[model samples]
Target: MEEKSFLDRMLGHLRETCKYYTGYPKYLGPSRVIHFTSEREFVQLLHQGYPVVVAFTIRGNYTKHLDRVLEEAAAEFYPHVKVLRVECPKYPGFCITRQRKEYPFIEIFHSPEQAANQGRVADPNITKYSVKVLPFNYDQSAYGFREFFKRHGIRSSPDPK
Candidate 1:
């Protein structure tokens, strides 16, 4: 296989292992949203130690995939931050909540990773927020998350790195 492809596989396997240890809902609290679709990237960022805010349209009419993402995030991290899985699909507009707004999409981000994913279209016309999006998947800004924290802040625990 190509070098990049091999790297991808390696990363995927590593992610799987990380997921196993990230702690699922059975071990978490209400502050975290399990299966946060828009937070897949965000959770990874958290593991890397970035503060972030994750928002999603949890209304029944919305996609189920998003729900799964929330579940995953909740299982992974809870009580550490605020996870808002909004049940309202449609916002102020008559337009369905699925509608994607323009750039600088207003959101609360505890970490730089979640802030970076803002307004980027990860899947299609649908912005990352519309789909079950992990914060990092929407944008690569979180790619530098590790260094960002190291330079400006300190994590109390022993960093696996």
Candidate 2:
């Protein structure tokens, strides 16, 4: 009886150790859509010299549809474009400051020279970078996003090595 109890305790300890090591997966696979969680991350992404598509959304059917569309777009345009989703309900202050009155609004921020030179390295020390914010007015679809990128001269794919 003492040996059985001791074995049970060891198993329990091993289970807890395994649980601690394997908490939760950050992502399932190679997810291109980045969920916005902090201001520092936002700033770092913007300064990475890639066009960023920021979707401001709340919890609803629209958000669900937009999330799928954004994920598809991000996958198709990986490395060239970065997609970010901001849950308005979770960050009400950010949405309010942005004057977001509707759900699933998207804005694209890109450097002025990004269209001409997509490989340009952005200055790290510069607090203020020249960026163009273009409001997305097209339909919420992968094709629409492609058209938007094409219309704005934003590269949809990374350059071939």
lDDT per residue for candidate 2 within 1-161, as digits (tens), equals 34568887886667545422244322323678998898778878987888899999878876777776787678767878999999888978777877767777999988744244335458755343457889999977778888988899988786679
- C-alpha TM-score for every candidate: 0.32, 0.69
Candidate 2 lands at a TM-score of: 0.69
Count of steric clashes across candidates, in order? 35, 0
Q: Which stretches of candidate 2 lie over 4 Å from their true place?
A: 1-29, 112-126
Error of 2 at 88 (Å): 1.0
Error of 1 at 22 (Å): 14
Report lDDT (CA) for all predictions.
Answer: 0.41, 0.77
lDDT of 2: 0.77
Please tell me which predicted candidate would have the highest TM-score against the true structure: 2
What TM-score should be assigned to candidate 1?
Answer: 0.32
Cα displacement (Å) at residue 151, model 2: 0.9
Off by over 4 Å in 1: 1-18, 21-52, 58-62, 90-99, 102-108, 111-136, 139-161
